[model samples]
Target: MSLIKLSNIHKRYGKGTNVFEALKGVSLDIEAGEFVALMGPSGSGKSTIANILGCLDSPSSGVYDFCGVNVSELNIKQKALLRRHYIGFIFQGFNLLPRTTALENVELPLLYRQVPKKERLRISMEALELVGLDKWCNHSSNELSGGQQQRVAIARAIASKPLFLLADEPTGNLDTKRSVEIMEILQNLNKDSKITILMVTHESDMAKYASREIVFLDGKKKSDTKEDS
Candidate 1:
C-alpha cells in the first residue's frame, strides 16, 4: 500500500520580488515497509520534502495523502495527534533532554499518549534493548558517547511503535564506523519489523543503506532507483 503520496507539490516562500519555490510540482509515492533515501545537495529541497512528509509543514499548493488521508486538510491539533501516534523522528542533532536518563527520554512520548507508567517503562526498556542500549538506560544524555546518544534517540523514537520513521542526517554526527552501525540497526528494523523509513542524506554511502534511492535537485525529483535485494 502507498503510505505516502504527494502530487504536484508546490511550496513557495515570500512573494513578489522575494518569492522562492522550495518545492516545485514534486510528486512521489512511498509504499508501506519501504526503506527510501532522499539524496540531494544543500538547498536541493530534501529537507523541505521530508518536513512535508512528516506533517511538520503544509505545502503551499498540493495534495499530500498520508495513509489514505489528506494531511494538508488536518488542523494543527489533528496533525499533532497523528504525528504522535504514527510518526517517529530522528534528527542530525540527537535531540534528547540533556539531564534526562535514556529510559526517561524514551518514555517521554508514551507520557503524551497517557500510557500507564508501568507499561510505559516496560516498552521504553524494550526499545532501549532493541538499540543495544538497555545497559545505559539510567545514563544521562551527556554521559553517553555520540553513537550511544543517537541510539537512545532512536529508542525514544521507536517507543511509540510508529509506522513511519523519518530521519534527517541521522548519521551526520557519527564517525564512519558508528554510522555503519546505526545504519545496520535501521536496516534490521526495516527488514525484521517492516517499519517504513524515509531518510534525507547527502552521502551516497548512507543512501546505499536504503532499499531505494530518490535524488532531488532544484526543488524537484531527479530520479528514483530501486536497489536489488
Candidate 2:
C-alpha cells in the first residue's frame, strides 16, 4: 500500500472572480521508505502539494489518503494529532528559538506530546546524535553555524521518530558544501533508518539526492521519474 495517495486533488483560494487555483487535479502516490523530491518554478504549486502532504492544508476537493486513511475526512484536531504523531517537518529557516539550546529545541515536540521529562531528554539526545550534533546539544541556536543550525532543526524534526519527514527547501539557506552535507545526512537516514522523505527543492542538484523526482508546472505534474542509483 502507498504511504501517501492523492487523487485528482484541487486547491483554490477565494471565490468566483477572485478565485485562484493552486493545484489542478494533482495526483500522486508515494510508497513507504522512499525518498521523493518535488521540483518546480515559483507558483507551480509545489509548496501547495508540500503543505497538503504535511497536513498543513487540506485539498479543496478530491481524495487524499495517507496510509490508507481518508485524510480529507479528518477534522482539524484529527489532522493535528496525525501531524504530531506521524509527520515531521524541516524548513529552510532553521526555525529554532534563538536563546534555546539544541537539546531543548529538539525536546519541544516531545513536550507537546506529553512525554515524560527524562524520556524526552533521552530521545532528544538520540536524535541529536543521529544528526551528529550531540556535542553541540548545550549550545544555543545563535552559537551554531548555518549547517549546525540545520542539523539541530533536523534533530528536532526526527525527535518524535515520525513515520515520514516533509522537508521544505531544507538546504535553501546553506552554501553548496553545507547543502551537500545536509543531503548526505538525509540520504543516510533514508537508507539506514528506512524513513520516508518528501522534500521540496528548486535546485536540480539537490533533487538528485532523492530516489525519485516529481516535477510540477503551472499547478500540474509535468514529470515523475526514478533516478539511477
Candidate 3:
C-alpha cells in the first residue's frame, strides 16, 4: 500500500476577488521506502504541498491519506498527533536552538512525546549516531558548522522514529560540498534504513539524489520520473 496518497487536492488563499489557488487538483502517491523529490520554481506550490503533507496545513479540498488513514478529515489536534508520531521534518534552516547542545535539541521531540528521560537520552544519542554527530552531542548549535547543525536537525527529526521524513530545501543554506554531504546522509538513511523520504528541492543536482523526481508548475504536477539506480 502507498505510504501517502493525495487525491484531487486543492488549496486556495483569500476569498472572493482576492482568491488565489495554490494547488489545483493535485494528486500523487508516495510508496513506502521511496525517496521522492519535489522540484519546482518559486510559487509553484511545492512548499504548499510539503506543508500539507507534513500536516502543517490542511488542503482546501481533497483527500489526503497517510498509512490508510484519512488525514484530510483529521482535526488539528489529531493532525498534531499524527505528525508527532509518524512524520519527521527537516528544513533549509537548521532550526536548532542557539544555546542548546546538539543532544538536547535532538531530545526535544522525545520530551514532547513524554518519553522517559533515560530512554529519551538513549534514543536521541542513537539518532545522533546515525547522523554521525554522536561525538558532537555536547557541542552547542552555534559552535557547529552548517553541515553539522543540519545533521543535528536530522537527528532531532528522526529521534521519534517517524514513519516518513519531509525535507524542504534541506540543503538550501549549504555550499555545494556541504549540500552533497547532507544529501549523502539522507540517501543512506533512505537506502540503508529503508526510511521513506519526500524532499523539496529546486536544484536539479540536489533532486538527482532522489530515486524519483516529481516536477510541479503553477501548482500542478508537470512530470514524474524515476531514475535508474
- Report lDDT (CA) for all predictions: 0.94, 0.96, 0.96
Model 1 over residues 1-229: C-alpha lDDT tens digits?
8999999999999999999999999999999999999998888989999999998989999999999899989999999999999999999999999999999999999999999999999999999999999999999999999999899989999999999999999999999999999999999989988999999988899899999999999999999999886
Could you give me the TM-score of model 1 versus the true structure? 0.99
**What are the per-residue Cα lDDT tens digits for candidate 3 across 27-92?**
999999999999999999999999999999999999999999999889989999999999999999
Model 2, poorest ten-residue lDDT window? 220-229
The deviation in Å at residue 122 for candidate 2 is 1.0
Question: Candidate 3: deviation at residue 102, Å?
Answer: 0.5
Residue-wise lDDT of candidate 2 within 113-132, one digit each (tens)?
Answer: 99999999999999999999
RMSD per model, one decimal:
0.7, 0.9, 0.8
Clash tally for model 1? 0
